[model samples]
Each structure stands twice: as structure tokens, then as C-alpha cells.
Target: MRRNGNSDRLSPIRVYEWMPVEALNTLLKQLEKEKRSLENQVKYSALRLEQESKDYHKTSRERCTYLAERSQVSGSYQVSKRQQMDQLPRMKENLVKTGRCNSVNQKTMNAMRGPVKKISRSNHLPKLNL
Candidate 1:
């Protein structure tokens, strides 16, 4: 019963018959190794990101504190300067009328002496309190 080359005949090999349990186990182990490696990389990246975030927050907080302090100091300085400017004309008038130097006018005349004197005078009680 020799068939022609064009005749339809079933092959002897079965598709599912090649399944080996050892080969399947090895493939699963390889997949697990890859998953573990990927997980480690993700963990490392997350840790680095967290550390960077903490550092950024710390730096931002320090900057905010510094700016706040600077603003406070500048505001005080501007207020003191404005007060001195307002009193300058009156002090000059007093000096012209009195012809003798007074303590208040002396302090006003030396307004640019230093911040220490200003701060000390600000904290001290006036002569009226004595």
C-alpha cells in the first residue's frame, strides 16, 4: 500500500508528549530568580528616593526658617529707621531752639552708632519712669 507524496498521512509525533517535569521546574526557578532580582532593584530605588525626599524636606525647612528670621530682622530695622526719620525734624527744631545739646537729640544725632545701643535703649525705661 505505497501512497503518493500528495497523500494525507498523520505524523508519529504527539505535541503534548514532550512535556518534561524537570524542564518545567528549571524554567520556574529561572523566572523566580528574575523576579527576585527585579524586586531588589525596586527596593533599592525606593530607598534612594525616600532618602532624597527627606534631605529635600530638611533643606527646605532650614531655608524657610532662615528667610523668616531675615524678614523679621529687616522689618524691625525698617520700622526703626522710619521712626527715626519721623523724629529727625522735631529733634533739629529742638536743637535750634535750645542752643544746648540734649540727651534725646544726642542719641538721635548718633542714630547710626550701632544696633546694640538701639536695642539697649529700647529695653531701658525712660527718664519719666525714674
Candidate 2:
């Protein structure tokens, strides 16, 4: 006959079986502490993921805004350049007219000087000399 609580399968495997109740309580507390630590780590990881997602979205929005602004600036620059190009021919025509006026004035001055010189030379010649 097997002794009570002494069966081969029912026998204690480790010394904890003979440990005080306080020691078991301490072990239970340690397991709870480890469980809480694991839970906190999971929470922190989840929060980090959420924060990263938000940051990514914000950065994407900022990038889109920057691109839009750049496009607008480029468009304005192109329009202004086109306007300037369109006005260039008129500006060139005005410049040509001013140059022509200056040339005409120079020619008039040269022609006036030639006649005055001729008259002065004629006056200085002998009265009877042809």
C-alpha cells in the first residue's frame, strides 16, 4: 500500500514544495512584477508606433505644402519672364529710334559745319579771285 501523499507521481520535485508560505508569496509577487514590466514595455512600443505615424503624416503634409509653394513661385517667375520677353521687342524698337535720332543730329551738325567752313574760306579769298 502507498503511503498517503507519497505516491511516485505526487511527490514534490523541488525544494519549493517545502518552502514557507512567505517565500511562495514572494515568488508570486516577482511574477506579477515581471508581468507588469512586460505590459509596460508593450504599452511604450504601441505609443511609439502611434507617435511615429503622426510624425510621418505631419512631415508628408509639410512636404506637400513646400512643393505647392515652390510650384506657385515657379509659375509666377515664368509668367513674369514671359511678360518681360513680350515687352522686349518694344524696348528694342525704342532704343533703335533713340539711336537713329542721335545719328541724325550728328549728321546735321556735320553738314552745318561744312557750309560754314566753305563760306569762311570764300570770304578769306581775294575779292577778284574766281
Candidate 3:
């Protein structure tokens, strides 16, 4: 690769030629510890994701079942409503042909109830002249 003119500006200036072995060993140990911690964190995150996926699937199934049951109930209600609508005209026609709405029930109810007695005002108070 050809060096760009800006590479000189980005490059770090060398202060020392080599690093000490003790310092290098300590740095390696720190990197190893960091690697182990990062690996543990990744494993924990993976398990959490798996649990969440399972819960999502279970909840999805339950929701689908609930929706299906709701649809079935609504469908039955709609069918019953349609049947009632279909029967309404026939019921009205029957009522008209039979002449059943001609106030006969009211007359019968009045006959069954008979008559009520009237109260007399002359029995309680006598005639007085002023």
C-alpha cells in the first residue's frame, strides 16, 4: 500500500525500542482475565435471550388460541343474529294473518280484573247547616 501524506501525522512517535518482559507478562494476564469475563457475560446474555424467545413463543400460542376462541364465539353470535333477522318478517306476517294484536288480550285482562268499589263521602260526614 502507498503511504498517504497524512500517515506521518497519524503515526505515534517512538519513545522506547522494546517493552520489559515483566510488564508484558502482567499485560497478558490482564488481557486473559478480561477475555474470561467477557466470555462469561456473553454466555449469560445468550441464556437470557433463549429464555425470552421461549416465553415469546409460549405467549404467542396462548394469544392465538384466545383469538381463535373469540372469533368462534363471535361467529356463533352472528349466526344467531342472522337467524333472528330472518324469522322477524315471518313472525310479523303470522301476527297480521292471525289478527292477534287486536286488543283482545287487554279486554281479557280487564274482564279478569272485574270492577273496583267506590268510596262514599256521606257515610263519614253528616250534613250540617251554618
Best by lDDT: 2
The lDDT-based order of candidates, best leading, equals: 2, 3, 1
Quote the positional error of residue 109 for candidate 1 in Å: 28
Q: Assess every candidate by TM-score.
A: 0.50, 0.56, 0.58
RMSD of 1: 15.2
**Which runs of model 3 end up more than 4 angstroms from their true locations?**
1-17, 97-130
TM value for model 3 = 0.58
1 against 3, candidate with superior lDDT = 3
lDDT of each: 0.79, 0.82, 0.80
Q: For residues 7-91, could you state the per-residue lDDT of candidate 1 as single tens digits?
A: 4343323332475878767878999999999999999999999999999999999999999999999999999999999999899
Steric clashes per prediction: 0, 0, 0
At residue 109, what lDDT does model 3 achieve?
54
Off by more than 4 A, model 2: 1-23, 100-130
Spell out the clash pairs found in candidate 2. Answer: none
